[model samples]
Target: RGGCMGQCWYTAVDTQLYLIAPLLIVPLHYFKDLGKAWLYIMTLTSLIIPGAITNRSLSDHERLYVNETYSTPWCRANSWIVGIWTGYIIFKTGNQLKLKKWQVVVGWTTAFATGWMVMLGMYNVNEHEATTTYIIYEACHRAAWAACLGWVAIACHNGYGGIVNGFLSHPVWQPVSRLTYGLYLISLEVQDDLVKYSRKNLFYFTTLNM
Candidate 1:
């Protein structure tokens, strides 16, 4: 549901992130259509995500986010915990040699499999699709990602040939990952507004959909 050109229109469906925010960001960034005002916001956001996600209290300050957090306890129990753990490990083992090629491959594969399995489990059983669930799920995903990236780096340390390593090490990954914050901000707001609008407007629904 949206006010298209100030006329209220109602719909039962709302699109997801890839379809929604990219629909907005791509044009803004690529076509150079955004006015000078948005440039400052985008630049500020790129700096905010890394640190915002790094610490837990940044989210704890807000009541809405506190309620929305999928991650429980928010401090001792979090993906940020994994981040702390990983950082400790890297610092402790900084001198150690990277994993052997076979070991790296197996580690990466295991990481990917575990990540997908965990996400599926969460999706099926977790009823709270709110902020809390999202935080926990994202934390899990981020931990898995850290493992995968760590292993991939080890795999590519000697030489890079495998498809996974090639893609991971691709020059585009850096830029794209940076934009994830912008994408996150843009998409979350858009989807929230879209869902709220739809839930309110589309009241006279048949049995076809909610």
Candidate 2:
């Protein structure tokens, strides 16, 4: 359980971000363009700091250190800031996104492409030889992932999502969504305990098992 408590760190990080969200959100609400500029600056800063730290501390042969790059609040802020940006846009538009047909087509195309790029772009890469490339990915990938999700959210909210919206917004998901927090809290510990106390070897691994 002690080792499995790593999953719980996100709750603490999320709470810290929620505590400070008003600092960013209030200005964006009241100041318009100036606040947007601040957000853009903050977004860029968030992207840079993680890469800078990785480059400074990690050798060219080393992978990113999880504690520094993955678990830190500042390193994880890029996605949170992107979410805030998406929410701000939705608020301003009154949840009515009106784009031309061509624009909608292009937005969905680009969103899917970006999502795939983030998902598969690292495959078979030689990280030890291309540490700089890994550093750049480390800095940008979370924000890119968030931006893709943001597009999905925007499109679904405004009926541009077609079948995607139908699947995501289906009533069947409501009860499952309610259990996600409890699942998140206990699933890791259960898995850890099963492995720790098992008397026999676990079943063979496969994608299905995963």
Candidate 3:
């Protein structure tokens, strides 16, 4: 771990095959049983052993090796699975859902609130965090985020997003959105350096740089 701590060449195991695994794992035929697959994937990824593996803090050795071997697809696959299913649903259902205005508003609002709570690290805010809760949160956070975005996508596709769709689809965001894939693949190096040697003044650092 020390040998390659700051080297960009030493890619994390989680990055291994990540660019291609989902392309292979999620099949178009699987969409034929979308509901069943959705339920199974959600339950396995959220309640099974693999879901809890990364929740525990890893030792240096473990971080360098074990995480690569055991945590990659198992721990992260739920997010992809849910996303695939959601896209299928949106494509198949289109505007046929015909949800009421209030329904869309309430559904998206609730999903957004739940996603925010999880994404903001609210579950670990306390000095004494519960292991059980953390495990559940770790397992479910990705699915929760995916679900929230799925709701937004559904609304946008079905013409129910109202203002949200207009804002998100604004032309000003097109260029930035195009860089999303590149950002996801490369930002870790820059972020790693900042976090690894940070001076501990988060507020000042964020204000100055972010």
Candidate 4:
């Protein structure tokens, strides 16, 4: 049953990594500037090298298990690393980096473009069957997404986002943000159950319609 829920193992691994990574990096974090550089290098290398090796070495089933357990973390660690680095920048600069009008346009454009590419890839995954190209995309997409988001954050924090900033900063979103952690914990199970139930009823629904 646990294995039937596709993301259950990944979620469990994610939980452990979230708790343990910071503790392991505490010494590195103490160095401020150097720490940020080290984290950037480490997370980038973690994303690239391991994925390249795994893609070349592992059999399909073995790769799937490795992705669920090992590869997912290496890819996702970028998000945490980027978040910490961006937070530090915001703190030190008081989030005051002013951009040119063109820069703001470029930032938002890149964000939308990369984000939509990720969505498109996921939508087409069955067609691609996690080919080497798709595997590379999966490994690198999150980091690209994170980079785009960092731009969005910079634009929003510095008041360059215009309508985008207004939408993101809306008071209504605050409550939703507050619920994010709880929702994050349970969402995989909810999604799995919903998917299973929907698939089970599909034939019945189709027959009724017919």
Candidate 3, superposed: residue stretches over 4 Å from native? 1-47, 54-71, 121-126, 192-210
Per-residue lDDT tens digits of candidate 3, residues 140-210? 77778888888888888888887999999999999999998677666778798798888675355566587
Q: How many backbone clashes does candidate 3 have?
A: 0
**lDDT tens digits, residues 67-182, model 2?**
67877789999999999999988888876779999999999999999999899878857544777787898899899999999999998888898999999999999999999999
Per-model TM against the reference: 0.42, 0.85, 0.67, 0.72
- The reply for model 2, stretches above 4 Å from the true place, is 1-4, 60-64, 190-210
lDDT of 2: 0.87
Pairs of residues clashing in candidate 1: 68-131, 68-132, 69-131, 69-132, 70-131, 70-132, 70-133
Candidate no. 1 TM-score: 0.42
| Sort order, lDDT high to low | 2, 4, 3, 1
RMSD after CA superposition, every candidate: 15.3, 6.1, 7.3, 4.7
Top candidate on TM-score is 2
In terms of TM-score, how similar is model 3 to the real structure? 0.67
Residue 68 in model 3: shift from native, Å? Answer: 6.1
By lDDT, who's the top model here? 2
